[model samples]
Target: MFYMSSGNDIPIDPDGSSSPIPDIDLSSILGNTLLIGIAIVVIAAPVVGFMAWEPVEEGNVKVVKKWGAASGTVFEPGAHFINPVSQSTVSLSTRPQAYTMSSQQGDGNRENTDDAITVLTEDGLRVDIDITIRYRVDSAEAVNFYKNYRGTDAAEQRLIRPSIRSVLRTEAGRLPVTEIYTGEGQTKLKAAAQETLQQDFNEDGLILETVQIRNVNLPQEYAQSVEQKEITKQRKQQKENELEVEKLEADRKRIEAEGQAEANRILSESLDQNVLTEKYIEKLNETDTVYIPVGGEGYPQFVRNIEGGSGQNSGQNTAQSTNSGSTNQSAA
Candidate 1:
């Protein structure tokens, strides 16, 4: 028989001996329900605790927000606690990142070239220049940065490239083409770009590390013209040098010829005309053939014969006088 607290006796089995089975153990059932409830709470508490908030690591910052919306405060690397229900975090790197842009050559064709800034020279020439930039996010200001410019590192790349390009273009436009190609123009351009970029990024709480100029390209036709002009200038200089050397050599030869003529004239004057005539007569006597330029109607030919005959006689007379003096001395 099944019996309730107000039991009347409804027979559950015909062979009922009615042993009074301990009524339904109410304490045990209640204890089991309580244990199950505790287990559920234990498992759920940790999951909720972790989701509510997390910590930022070393050399990093967590940009926290109330779900989709940003919070003004940036959290530096270290332990932090947040509401498990309301906030989420985005991590940003504090280390510097490098961006390299390729350069082009003399031809207008760009090879491995990226977006570049065009600059004008003092002479109103246009030149394209490539740039490289290295930078990072300052962790202390990271939270403000996120609020101002939200997103990931990809967002940083987007923001920085455009900013650099803008600054470069502005600076390049202010410079003259001649200065960019030569002189201190390149240095000034780099400094100007750097200063502008740093100022803008700093205002936005971005850290600027380095800036570089990769390539500067001009028109092919202009390049060729410059080369030709340089070559012509060099050739003209070489010709001028050669002319100077030739002038010096000609002057030296003229001076030498004039000196020799002066010496001959002086010697002729020292000896007198008679001495020159006597020397000519002596030379004619010593040679088998005597020739002289005929001038004034046969006078030169007549003088030549007379000089030759007189020179021979005087030589014979002088030899005889010398021989006679020697013989007299020996007798004495």
Candidate 2:
């Protein structure tokens, strides 16, 4: 039999002198275990929470890939529980970006000294083309883009770079290299390149904003030849301008001569025989001899000075005079 001892802290059993189990605080032990479990739960809650949810930032989307999930799985910008045990998230940016290929290092997206594209023109000239591409992932087609390239970086290297190179080469082969050297031709080339590359971009779920030809470098001899050709063209234009001025001067001289000849013809047509006889009588006292018109010609008539005998040579002058050419005088 178990019996109570003198104090409540100890008890006696029939087979043993004392029993320590009877003196143990059972209520306290139970209470301590419950508190310890509560503490463990409180400590582990935050850690589990962190592992369960992902935060997506602005301008970014998360692609959650799970075993049973379709390839089109996506998550927008926000905190979302993705079940850390089974699903994974890849953050992708949708902002526009640019890729510059250039011949000089540090001037382009590439680190190489000469990352410019080397292409052959239809005219069989080699040129280095520096181009830039502005692009972005199509948000609606992000899944397809990711599936095709796995990431934006891969898309730039494999699709963007290669497509630009291929399209530029194709366009360069369609025309002479001299055409590409002109502003309008460069514009045309850029348009064709952008158009062709845009098709490639669209098929691959990428958006091509712009394609720019930053620079084009021809071989040294070709560059010199182009410069000389431009000089020749300028010279030809100058010569044409000079010839135009000369033509205008010749027209002015021709007009002046025509006006003078027209005035002389009008004067000759206005004069008559009556006006000629009056003019000859008005000048009779000023001359020793006069020309009188008989038919279409003139005959000289001498004027004798009776008061002074001043006109001494009038007779000699009349003897020598014959049919002169002055028809403006009448009988005087």
Candidate 2 has a TM-score of 0.63
Collision pairs in model 2: none
How many angstroms is residue 252 displaced in model 1 relative to the true structure, after the best TM-score fit? 23
lDDT of each: 0.69, 0.77
Cα lDDT tens digits, model 1, 1-332, are: 54443466543454654444458988999999999999998998888877765788887888888867877667787788888677778888887766655554332223445456666655677787867777888877787677777643554466666776677767777776656755376677678778877887787667888887767777688878877988999999999999999999999999999999999999877986567767876775565444554534333533444454436554454455345435545654
Residue-level lDDT tens digits of model 2 in 58-122: 88887777764534778787779877777777777888889889999888887867899998999
Off by over 4 Å in 1: 1-26, 49-55, 78-81, 104-113, 152-159, 226-332
Number of backbone collisions per candidate: 5, 0
Top TM-score hit: 2
Highest lDDT, which number?
Answer: 2
Output the lDDT of residue 154, model 2: 91
